[model samples]
Target: MTQQTKGKASALFPLLIFILLFIGTGVLTKDFSNMPLNVAVIIAAAVAIFMNRKVKLAKKIEIFTKGAGHENIMLMCIIFVLAGAFSEVAKGMGAVDATVNLGLSLLPANLLMVGLFLIGCFISITMGTSMGTVVALTPIGIGIADQTDIPMALAMATVIGGAMFGDNLSMISDTTIASARTQNTSMSDKFKTNFFIVLPGALITALILWFITSGSHINQLEDYSYNLVKVIPYLAVLIVAILGVNVVIVLIGGIILAGAIGIIDGSYTGTTLLQAASQGVLNMEDIAIVALFIGGIIGIIQYNGGIDYLLHVVSNKIKSKKGAEFGIAGLVSVADISTANNTISIIMTGPLAKDIASKYNVDPRKSASILDIFAACWQGIVPYGGQMLAVAGLASISPISIMPYSFYPVLLGICGITAILFGFPRRKVKQ
Candidate 1:
């Protein structure tokens, strides 16, 4: 028989300390970038290890290693590395510029904000990373704001809203991967459940942007050049992923296709292709390390009964399935708000959310959807979040300036909550 861990609120102190150290440094320094997330997690892991005197040191080390080396966690880290490599290889081959130009060239000048939003959505979905999308589109948005009557904050907010939309839905996104894996569901299954819930919000946000920018027009529009061939890899990745192919295979294929095209088009030499791939893998190092640390810390916490304590408290308050869903949403939202990174938030809250879902007989797909949606919602709007901060810095504006105009995240939060209450897109419970 398996051992049953007792609930212990004191076990959560280490997690609390990590949060305080992370958020505290950011708050005091007035710059979140000053304190690296991995550093914060390392301290938290140490605290978790040293606590609980009753457990032997040897057993604690075993628990930590087991969690760090868990199949799901290891798989997640590998995906992050592969995703980074594919993204870098694609960008090095001029895929990003080509995709951006192609989208902008086709958009109407009069509908600039709407165009930006739509293009941001498309690029972010294909890129599978919002940070990259925001970086690529913010300059374009700034130029539009300067040339036209659009407010800089509004233009930047449009980019942010669209990026968040894709970040929440993309098949290759770290947030989506973490949520789906932690909930024990497939990415395609989670995407389907997530898409329907957020579609209404996206449509509404697009319409709002259209109405706001309908009267605006650029004084002089530049004709952007693009290569259609460079765009094929992104499309293939998206399509293949949706068709339920293995994620690792899809990413590997994308890298090969992108690298081949880059080499043929003279965008990359044989040696440069290897360099780009290595750079991409290096770019993902921080997140991969953070994931390992978080896994170890969470493993320690679980061993010390922190997760059971949380489950006990949450279970006492949750009466129905809908309440249980809300509990899951709230848990992830708080984590995102605290961490300011949607992917990390999902990872931190996922194990607990899975426990809640199983106890309430909630669908794993739906639980995964809730985790991604809520995490993205808060991450998009929070001024401290990387998306908002990056866009704000690029546009030379305050992060707070972008929040009011970030309509998608607000609408998404509403839609997510409504989906929980009314159970829209209802699926028959599996027997």
Candidate 2:
């Protein structure tokens, strides 16, 4: 019994060590970006190895290898690679510029802020990535702010909100993929469950944005030239994904189509597409590495009884389906807060959430939805998180300034709680 207790305590320690090293070092340096997350994860992984003295070094290494290469982790890594390639190729072929122009052109001057939010939402949904959406739109958002009476913080907040919205719901999104995989549900099922929960919140956010920015006007309406042909790739990806194509197939098709269009449009010649695709894959290195380390560390933690301990403690408090849902939500939120990465948080909490869901009979789809929503919420509002920092950097403003204006994440959190309290979506349990 003492041996089992020791194993559980040792298993839980690595996560705490990782948190302190990652967040603590960032706090000390006054720059979270300066500390590579991969390094901190590696450190924690090493500590995890050291703590398990009972296991031979070779066996410990074998266990870490198995976790790192687990089927789900490997699948996520493949999607990351493909998604990265698609995003870079699409950007290289001018898809982002065309999409942004097309989106902005459709809205009147009075609803420019709303247009920014919608454009962000559309871009993220199509691209299947929040970071990419923010990177592509924050500059435009800042440009609009500079040319108009709108405040910078508010403008940045709009982009962040829309980014989170798409991130929470996009079928191709890493969070969506991780959530669905972790919960052992299909992405479409999770999306269906998630959509109803957050749709009203999104609509309400748009309404509020329209009201708030109603009085603001652009100094000069900048005319943008959009090539409709360049917009086809994004539309193709979104349509295909919505049709429930295998995610890998969806991304592969996007890459090939984008490359063909770029070649025909004179946007690429010879190896340009190849080079762009390679660069895109390289961009995903950090995330891919972090995923491997997290998987391995989590494996070790589980082997040492860490996950069982967590399940025991959490399951003890779960009295009903609502409590189980809340536990899943709370677990991912705290993990995302600590890691400052929603995808990582989802991966870390996925297995444990499954256990809780199984024990309390929470619907897998709802559990997945709750995981994605809460992770997105915490990620959007946390000043230190990547989403906020990315927008803040682009707008040349403090992340703290972007916090109050993050309406979508805030509203989504409120709605998520309401859903749990009222048992929204009302799914039937599997017999």
Candidate 3:
């Protein structure tokens, strides 16, 4: 048996510093943009290295570098780069515009709200990012609300809810990659597990939207022109990913296909395609750097027994497998609320959740699902969260105004909690 390390409260000081620095700056400045997450993590990493004086500075640096260079962390960074490239290439080629227009063109006037939600879901799943989906669809949603009787807040909420649906279950989502890798589970497996749990919530949300908007009628219907050919890359990526192909291969193929399509359609020249790909990779630089910093900081903390202390305390309070699952859910939820970023929350909480799953005999896939679902649940509704802030900004309304109408996330939480309490979708633990 491996030797057990004693838990130490001081080991967590670095993490506390990160949270305080990140949240305090946002609160004080009333602008989260004032303190970037990567900068906060770098500061925290510095503090972690400076602490634990008995350990040689050289040894601390080694530990931090080792964590940053860990296989899973490196893989995640690579995937982020590739995902960014594909997304940017696809968008550069007009895939996002085509997809949005196609969905809008096909929607029935009576079911406009429900149609917006479904379109948001499809875009986010294919895009593998909620922020992109919200940005692409919020304007359309705002237009729909302006032309129809739908409340602006409800319309914005619908877009956010749909975006988060895919955020929780999309195979290419960073949250999926982080949760699956940290727990040593396959993306397809986690997607399947997550799909069933969130399906009920999604359906209920659709029904609720339809019920409310069924009586509403649009003042005028506008036709949006789109070329279906531009949407093939997105469809190809989604299909191949769901078929259990390797994620890295899937992303590389997507980038190539999107670039080729863009080139053939005259949407992008060779130079522009390369430039788009470069810009896409650049867009992901901050998150990728943050991931590395977080890995290093977490490594230092774990080496100093912070994680052991966390596990010891959690294991004591969590008496059953069910409780362990709840603990994982709560842990990520709090992390998401604090960071206002679901991807970062998963990165921070995944290791601890993995440990909890191992001790409680909870399926890694289930643990990953819980981590994604709960983080997404809070992310979709938190007033300060990116999704809410983006949609609220687009609608020119308060983020709090969108909260009550965020039915999908609220229902998603209910379904996730119910799955844990009832052990729904029972299956044998993977060997």
Candidate 4:
């Protein structure tokens, strides 16, 4: 038991230091961005390597390289690229305006809150990215908030909560792919477990959002009559994504569809199309660069056996099914906090998670679902999370202020934990 405690502390030391530096700096300056999150994550990762006394520096570098270059990160990067290109190309061609207008027209003033929440969920689910979902939807959410006189925090949080729902649950989502692949569970099975757990939380949150915004009223406006042809691309993207088409192909097809429409409508010149694509890709520059660094750093950690050290220590602590579930949660949470990437956390902790599941006879699907869902619940509420950062940038608000409004993530975690305690998603035990 002492050894188990020691392992947890040793594993957590880097994270403790990171929070001290990262959050400490921000609190002292009252500026979250004062200490760059990327730089801080790198520094913390180095410290993590140093803690591994058993591993050599050169070997550590190799592990970090392997983890960073893991096939999963590459796949997420591909999604990021496609999302960037599509959003850019579509925006350049006035698709956003037309789409937003069409949505506004369909959603009555009384249902604005519900409308925004649903839209946020739909877009994130389709986009497989919470940040991209936010960027695409926020300006419009904000406009509606202002025009409707709804509380900004509540409105912003509504969208954020919905976005996280998809980020955590979407089959093509990076977090889902990471956790499922990591735990050696079937993606379809994980989805079943995940959906069952999160469905109630989403329903409850939606009702709450509805209640919260029910008192507010807005003047209804006429729906913008845009060409039905212009709506085809976005609509098609949605339909194909929901049908389980490959995400990369979905994005590429969406881009092509949008571009063709743009050229046909004279909304985009050939030069504009190329320029928008370039510019759109450029928007993801920070994460793209940071992802490369993070991959390399984790590769070193892996090479040094730091990750194996965690596996040894954490796996030893499991004495029961409940303990195993908590351990899975702990593993992913630590990796998520360390990596500052929920999907990466799932990837990093996957092997260990699988081992723990096997030892405890805990359901693999449940294990994977728990890891992804909890990581997202934490990630969504974190001030430093990418979703918060992007939303804060677009909404011009502090992350602290937005935290209270993220009702969906908060409730999702609550309900998810409850699900575990009650064995809520009791699957037929696979003999």
Candidate topping lDDT: 3
lDDT of 3 by residue, 385-428 (tens): 65675565545565656888999999999999999999876877
Model 4 lDDT on a 0 to 1 scale: 0.73
Off by over 4 Å in 2: 1-7, 108-200, 207-221, 318-410, 419-431
At residue 116, candidate 1 shows an lDDT of: 84
Q: Relative to the unseen true structure, what is the C-alpha lDDT of residue 186 in candidate 4, on a scale of 0 to 100? A: 80
Better of 2 and 3 by lDDT: 3
Off by over 4 Å in 3: 1-6, 108-200, 207-222, 318-413, 416-431
**Local distance difference test, per candidate?**
0.79, 0.79, 0.80, 0.73
Which residue ranges in model 1 land beyond 4 Å of their true spot? 1-6, 108-200, 208-221, 318-410, 418-431
| lDDT, residue 391, candidate 4 | 58
Residue 215, candidate 3: Cα error in Å is 11
Q: Give the range of the ten consecutive residues with the poorest summed lDDT in model 2.
A: 1-10
Model 2, span 242-359: residue lDDT tens? 5556667877998999999999989998599999999888776666677778778777877888765654554456677788898888878766754567897798778888988888
In model 1, state the lDDT of residue 333.
81
What would the TM-score be for candidate 1 when compared with the true structure?
0.66
Please give each candidate's TM-score: 0.66, 0.67, 0.66, 0.75
Ranking by TM-score: 4, 2, 1, 3
Candidate of highest TM-score: 4
